[model samples]
Target chain A: MSGASLAIPDRLRLLRGANNEGVLAVVLLALIVAMSIANPAFFTLPTAFSILRSSIVPLIFALGVLMVIISGGIDVSFAAIAVFAAYTTVRALQSGTPDLGLIGAFALALLIGASLGVINGFLIAKFRLPTLIVTLGTQGIFKGALLTYVGSRYIADLPASMAQVSTTNLFEVSTPTGSAYLHILVVPAVLLAIGLAWVLRSTMFGRSIYAIGGDVEAARRAGIRVMRTQVAVYVIAGTMAAAGGMIYVIMGRSASPQILVGSELDIIAAVVLGGASIFGGRGSVLGTTLGVILVQVIYNSLILAGVPSAWQRTAVGVLLIIGVGIQAVASRRSSRASVIDETYQKQEVPA
Target chain B: MKLADPETKPLSRLNDSVDAGWTRLLGLGRIEGGVRRMLILVVVAFAVFAALKPSIFLSGTNLRNIALNSPEIGVIAIAMMLAMLTGGIDLSLVAMANLSAITMSTMFTAVAAGDPALAEQLFPVILLAGIAVGVLGGVINGLLISGLGITPILATLGSMQIYNGIAVAWTGGKTLYGSPSALTAIGSSTVAGIPILFYVFVLVAVAIGVVVTRTPLGLRIQLQGANPTAARYSGIASRKILLSTYVLTGLLSGIAGVLFIARNPTASADYGASYVLLVIVIAVLGGTNPNGGFATVLGVVLATLTLQIVSSGFTAMRLSAYQYAIAQGLILVAAMAFEQVRWRRRRRSRKPAVQPG
Candidate 1:
């Protein structure tokens, strides 16, 4: 090959190594601009707030899954966990028991989610089974149990306080078309993302997660409690899934048995789009947050563009493939570069 | 050069040991092991179902119904077995099947609407087109996975959505009817009291089993899944093997789709959505290794029958449809967990023995 032609792969490899998030951001910006151009109303403040509000639950889920994925595992059953948690909490609230405060309800939901996560973690870590398959089985069991016990009822009769919490806004801004309000849950969602980002960046446990994901045997040799860390990762993922479900119920004013079923694809696509490698050991809360936003924006924009909602799943699927394709190409190039570097260093060392 | 060769010898030996360890850990070469376990489960399920509702569960008509229903999911499960044997999964099988059925049914309906006699003559052509849709779907999946290097799960997941979306868009989520008599006969008609669909399932399963076990291509697939790097070094075309496995799955799925429409006499974009999980469950329960390298077609066939019995048994016992999902999930988890335990025990027992020469 000519020198100039060879330089093209090198340049592409360089781009892949360093600019994954940068590329995603560019794509997001282009999509926003395109949507704004197609529908002038898209860039309005109200629509922006609406998109953010809608993104909160999925963002929560994406953050959880991002961590799990980075730790070399996948959790498809989070949707089921969310359903079970949401259903139980909604049922308890609707049963007219002595008012357990909002905290109690949140605790109940989180506890259930974490417990389910523990079961998943234990099975996967102990049995050394594939995470995808384990979670796939659990996903079915959880949904089936819910259906059997709960009978597919929609729990719309939430406590007055919980319903009020949904409408309770932190701030309201008037726009040309309408006013927009940031709901109360938005603060917690943002805080969770920030807290998780901090933990992933700063904590010893978080570093161990990355280490294990990068090379499990190495991590084990280095005395990282691989099993414990894995269980913790699933627990965190489960908790976030539960939190997302609760948010969905509170903000949407209804909890149904079917809530979040088959929505794992959206959550996963968002994380992957945000620059998380499905193979693990790479991802961030910030990237996942942006990914969630980009996905929601695309989804909302599609509806605004009058594309039927059925096509949205197709769009997400395409996005997933593209995102994964980019990651695969980048990682392959980087590995190849390192291999070449190792060979070059060996040659120079003998001289 | 002699010194370097000596240095590399130990490393190669270590690699060989690691390979052996994995095969032994998963009991990969023990094809008969899964078959025996599945056979026991099938017998137990039959006994339990018969005990619960002898009149309905053991009835000739109910037995025939189970046989009829088993093929649709069984055929897909066989396809899934091939995919899993190569250490990949095709989540798009159900979607491909539905899309193919929809395409075939739509074409048939349009033709019949225009000229009933001509539609009758072209019925076989329409069925072939449906099978073609499945093959096309498979080829697309194979390219995305083998060519682009996307993981099987993500690649098929995307294809599943795309294929399903196309079906939905084409049908506007409406069910299409009017299958030709000949097409329906393939599903509903029987020879010597045995359903035609069962024969098709058996034929596909046996053909695949023979190809995978008795042929060089099958050996290549096993080697590729067992150790891809070694397989590559040994001159196996990894991409070609992967591509062919997915294409074969797609073809099987297409056949299943055609049979699906043949039996139901209607095609819907969303048909057999639930079978996605069911087929995976069947494949896994049948002892196909999710991590690849080892699979038994007979195991899958037995597992399919076992599941069909449990399903119709539940109906006989008047259990809610929700119970069926619960049982399926439980059985899948239990089977996998049992396999893991058995493998671990075998590994532990083998560890104490002297290394084989």
Candidate 2:
């Protein structure tokens, strides 16, 4: 096994190790400076805080998708899952369920999301279906169910307590230009990112995710519980999506069945841009966070630059192509280098 | 060899017997098993619908409605089948269609406004140009996938967005209407009470079927998809094959778009956003292997009719459109699952019958 691993060229390994985050950091810094120079107001604390605040929902979704990508699968149904979970919570609150406070609503959302995840997990793990096709089906089913059961109506009559929970400011800073506030949701979002990052770095389950993604047959031979790990990854994704949904409803003070329809692309683009490979086995919490921030910054700067909103989709599409193109080239080069190294090592061993 | 051992022989024979029983129960051996199952399903759905709405379901107008509605989807579904046959998918099909339709219709509207006589003469040109634009879209996708090495899904996904954006920007998100009567006739007119659109679909389907079964290009595509490394080592140009498949898909989808505007006489950037998933369902339901290398034009045709019947049935039954979506999703999942199970069973059955080493 050790000899097999040594087939990878050291230079390629080193480059892969530093690739995504380093490029992103430089690009992010350049964009920030450029934006600030173009519009001095963009550099202000209030603007920065607003950008951070708007990123919370997508950040949560991105973290979940990052885990899915790292585990060698993809889930576009998370947005639908989030919508279902949020609608359930709002409907529960609107029903005037006594003692079903914000915490209870949140718990309910998580439970519903987890159950849906379990269905996705069972089908993909047991039957060995492609995650993309399976999720595409489930996305339709979930969205259809939402439409049939909940209609297209928005839920606005939420408990005042829920609104307060979302609006509760963690801290505020007053500057000469203006004041900036941080919502309470940011704390949980940051903590979740940090905790997941730690898990990926230090835990056996986390290591197994990488192994499985790197090579399923090898991972199985190494005694990794592939099915269990896959299910766990999806469940975690579902739970996180639910949390994101809760935050969305709280922030907006309403829930619509159509919420987050077609926004999964944005989440996926952010994760891919941050350094995560869609093929799996490569990603990090830190990289994903930066990806989320970078996507937000690009979106913000485009708006500030007075570009049409429709062009924003074009920009995101272009960014996705470029980012994925670079990753593909890098991976291809690395794989080719490894092949050459393997042959060279074999020749040297005989000599 | 393991077969020389008397003790192992009984176990192997018993395993074979059990596998044979399961395979028999599942109807797993035949290549046409999927078609048989789909035919049965179609029969059952037709019977149920006919029973519920005896007058309307069996009426000529309703039948024509099904015929008219299915070809647009049928044309695109065939293209989707081609893409899937190459072990790639074109998520940008609908986007390509809309973009090309917008371009053609926009050109038509402008030309007609300035010179109606020129517009009449250029109608065919405009239609051809729309299809050419679709081919251009496919060229872009082929370049992205084969030239740049992006995965088909991601490549097409990105292109889907880009094409959609361009369409939106081009028309400012407005609908382009009023194509010439000659153009509309291709979509709406019928000879001897049969829709020309249906005839076009059948003709295209038969042509594609013949080409796929008989032509060298089709053979190369099948070979590339079945095993690209083997195909490449055998001197086939895998990249060129892939590029051609996508281009073919774009051409078909472009034709579908033209027909769409011919019938509706309107082209919009946002038109047929829902068809993306629906076409995938139809292709998969038709037994075009999602992983590629195996497809049937006949299967696609049958599947289109089956779905069209169900859709029209649902409409006559007054069920909501969401119900149709639900049915499509369920059908896609069930069809794929059935294929997976059949594959696994076939693999298992093949194992024991192999000569022991």
Candidate 3:
């Protein structure tokens, strides 16, 4: 599998292989070029940084969704988990728990998220209830509970550590037009992505994830611990969601219980558009990253491209349907079979 | 609660089609286990609420409000349940309802052109337009899923976004207030002490339920969901069934849309955004198998009543809607959990004998 052991043509072939990343890369490049032609400011370093800045939380959340999707399940409750966990931590800190440093607060958020995710895993793995229904139910339950029992108001004043962290900059550039700033916030998102990519690519646990997603019964037959893998998948998903929520709050220097209330479909759409299948068993971190960037660019730069924001949702939806429609047709061509046969075959080959 | 009461004229007179359909479903003697359980839950919820607030909870006005509020969610739930019955879900039905409602409301607004009196006269045309939009939306969903081979979830999710976006763009994300006066009258008025829309809902639900249990299309839908491979070998056209499944659900949405604009008097892109999950909860609580192939009309009907009572009971006790939301979630998870545990125990009990053998 090492690149060093392969010939030049083999390396090229590998680079141009079965993933959606290559197609996504080309589309992203074309969009960027088009946007630049439409508006010169769109190509600037400042614009790039701003796009990168705005996409941070969504990128984090998309990774979690990508994992869950690859594991043959879906998680709509991540948004709920994210806000609930982050809000709980922020509320506890606001309610007079002495400075439990930023690390402490983060750990608490992750812990709360993991515990909540355990509930999802338990119901799903033990009961085999449909993931969509379970998550949907919990989404309401988590948000409803937070608003009723916990505080619903925004906390603009945070603990000193969180307050200071929001202002910390990794670097900044001055220009005649607009300044380009890279906040320290980029580090965590980058680190988390790298860590997740490595775990998903190199670890046995990662392989188990792919296995289970490909076929749960087959994975069990092949000696993988399907239940344990599934539980861990949800836990990791919850923790990442919590991280996304915390990132969102810290970036804005304010925490609200209602943050990210209805953003699940958007994130899931991004994951699927990245070449992940809703039926499960195939996705790549690289594809997801590009998918996030593609969706973010379209969403952020529509105005620059001379489109009104009112049409943004329509644009995204059309693009998604067109994108997935192509994949569906291509798969059908490869196997002349009925609907049931098609679904069954997809789980087997995963491409 | 006058839910089953016949204070007005005979219910059969409302829709002849529904009356014919009823003959097919009413003859079944075996009660599904899930339906029986759901009925118990409904009765329990009703009894508890009636006992707690005998004065106001069971009052005619409050009971009337429950019946009035029930149809919108109830009709939409039927659509959701039908989709799930075929092993798919239409996440866009809520959006479909909105789009169709918008189409209907826009017609009323455009035709009337400030003549509220004239808008009242174009009722039948406007109602048909609303349902037509729903059918159009469903056709698109069907094409994507069955024609293009896209999975139903992705297909519906994408369509939901598109439909919702179009509605938002058209209305600039604001409420386009103005339904036909006739529709508004239907929404607000009661006939012989019962809401007219309630009659529509019951008629529609019973008609569809009968068709689901009695017709070839209904049996084929269940067969496909129950075992797609077997259905395929049996020469059932999965594509046609899937398409018809969505189309039928769409037709229901159109009906719900007419009811929606009538009830709300305004059409908007983002109305009832929260109802998606609640609809799914209702469908599942009614014993619609999320994995597909099995569902019950009586069960779903009772489950809707149960939740409405529980939600209305919270109001009567001065409790917040959020608490009721939590209860909705708990009821679902707890029910599934109990089902899972009982099955696990049964399987465990059988394991010892198999090991010895």
Candidate 4:
């Protein structure tokens, strides 16, 4: 009875809740605390920096995917796009007379990502073809192109400046145990995450993405150019995935078709685990960051605990099931709330 | 909205009759929306194949090759069509097929250990083992999706990983060789100017066709898939229907696995991974709408032939392996575009017919 009379301010705050990001923050804190207690070495700066380095590339792509999902679509070609981008960049460097050099290569790769994303958007939004079908076809095309372009030959030697990004670390940070560690190339990833979160929260375009996803037809009727917004979303996603791919090449020191063969599933799962709906509209970049961390943590913990690497796939499989299950439950609750709302509204109307 | 205006009613009726007649003649009325497209694709494909490879296209040997290659996929396609028809997908079919292949191959190698001739004689035994493994896999998928409230796509996806993992683990990532001769004979031997496996595929397809067209069970499944909420409200058990379809698909895929083992005489971790996309493509191309309540088995069979010819043509032409991916993608795009064109045409013609009244 008292809840029904709640203040508008309190209700709005409740409706636009802190969401899955808050859950992620709690999970991150709990993970750090538990891991630290289990192994004091876990809290050391070196270990932390190493984890950060490992997380950078995936984290970047995950942000891009988070944007796509929030805009109510999916891009399964992220890994493929990244592979192509890396291939292009490496092929550029190998010719000695580097066309775009490092910065130019990355910019071109991002442009390709965005362009391919636009193609995906055109097929899905304009043609009214199912997203799954178009993406599946595009994925095949991307993979095929990668295979044909590289033809099993990997570029081993790269320009020193480009290769040095992975190994270069900042000054050492002192730890409680009198130990010190350096930050690796992942230094940029952390900065990128913070910047992305800021833009997503404060920008007008970011708000439009949420609005479009939440109610596409309504948004369109309200004079929002749905097609353009969706196309822009895919372009951004493509660019980010391209950036992630480059980072991956830097870390791994080579680009292989098999490197991230089944990685798209992991990216999607991470986004879903972070509580993003496959149906679109509601999600957070912070939540996705945690989702990636959760996945990595699970993988890392399993390795540290001496579990076989094969079981890592099983862990992902199980996590996917659990993630979908939670989403299903959440969907049911939201629908039930709508039903209750309708009933209340009908009662408020004149007989 | 009144479809009975005097000025248009007679012409509309005539148009409806012609549409119905045309669809029935092509076997489109026997299933759902996609089946008609598949039928059209088959015509387009056969004409193209015959034109491109005239000498070999009409030859008995090539026709027999098409037959032999089909059963392994054909049976599985039947199950897959049912699953897709119900508004769900079974990504695990290929994985299940691999598992069954491994199981059968393992059983063959075990029973005939150091006795190749004896293993050759026990072909039926291997086939039974493959079918059994497939049924078991299907049961697991059905139970998980139906009994556990898991969505078909996610459930099957999870099962895909699990099945593949089990297959890999069971074989310890090693290929199983020295399969039974009887199974191989079923794959290779010709009977009455046709391949044995082809007959088996025909029988399976016809059996499934009959079940889908004539049985109450099939009717309930179609109803359930067409609208789960409506079906559930009408007292149909949607969960059971879904579970049974998954089971059916798994069982058929298992049969396909055995045929694959029989033909290849080997099983590996990578045995069925490639088939996953191909299977979906063929099923969709065959005229089985994943969200529709009906499918055309014959259309799928014809489309399979067309696709196989295209694949063989590509290989024969010495194209890069990557080209096959491009071809498949293009074909899928074309099929979808064709469906959209037909849908638009139907919508356009119907609007004018209604508006004039």
DockQ (model 4, Cα) = 0.38
Candidate 4 lDDT over B337-356, as tens digits, reads: 67877788889888987886
Name model 1 segments beyond 4 Å from true. A1-19, B1-31, B355-357
**What is the lDDT for B253 in model 4?**
82
lDDT of 3 by residue, B1-357 (tens): 658558344654666657766765675655787888898898898899899998889999889888988898888898898889988898999999999999988888887886767778878888998999999999999989899988888889899999999999899999988887777888889999999989988998899899899999999999988999999999999999999999988898888888888888998999999877888999999989887899987777777878888988889888888889889999988777776677789999999989965
Better of 2 and 4 by lDDT: 2
The ten-residue window of minimal lDDT in model 3 chain B covers B7-16
RMSD, every candidate, angstroms: 8.2, 7.4, 8.5, 5.9
Off by over 4 Å in 2: A1-19, B1-31, B355-357
Q: What level of docking quality does candidate 2 show? A: acceptable
Per-residue CA lDDT of model 1 for A230-317, tens digit only, reads: 9999998899899998888898888898878787866887887787777788887767887888889888999999999888878887
> What TM-score does chain A of each model score against the native chain A?
0.91, 0.92, 0.92, 0.86
Model 3, which residues run further than 4 Å from truth?
A: A1-13, A337-351, B1-27, B114-116, B343-357
The lowest-lDDT stretch of 10 consecutive residues in candidate 1 chain B is: B25-34
The prediction achieving the highest DockQ against the true structure is: 3
* DockQ-derived CAPRI band for the predicted complex in model 3: medium
Q: Which residue ranges in model 4 land beyond 4 Å of their true spot? A: A1-47, A96-99, A149-152, A170-184, A195-202, A257-259, A329-351, B1-40, B43-65, B108-129, B352-357
TM-score of every candidate: 0.91, 0.90, 0.91, 0.85
Model 2 TM: 0.90
Deviation from native of the Cα of residue A106 in model 2, angstroms: 0.3
Tens-place lDDT per residue, model 2, A324-343, is: 88877777898999999999
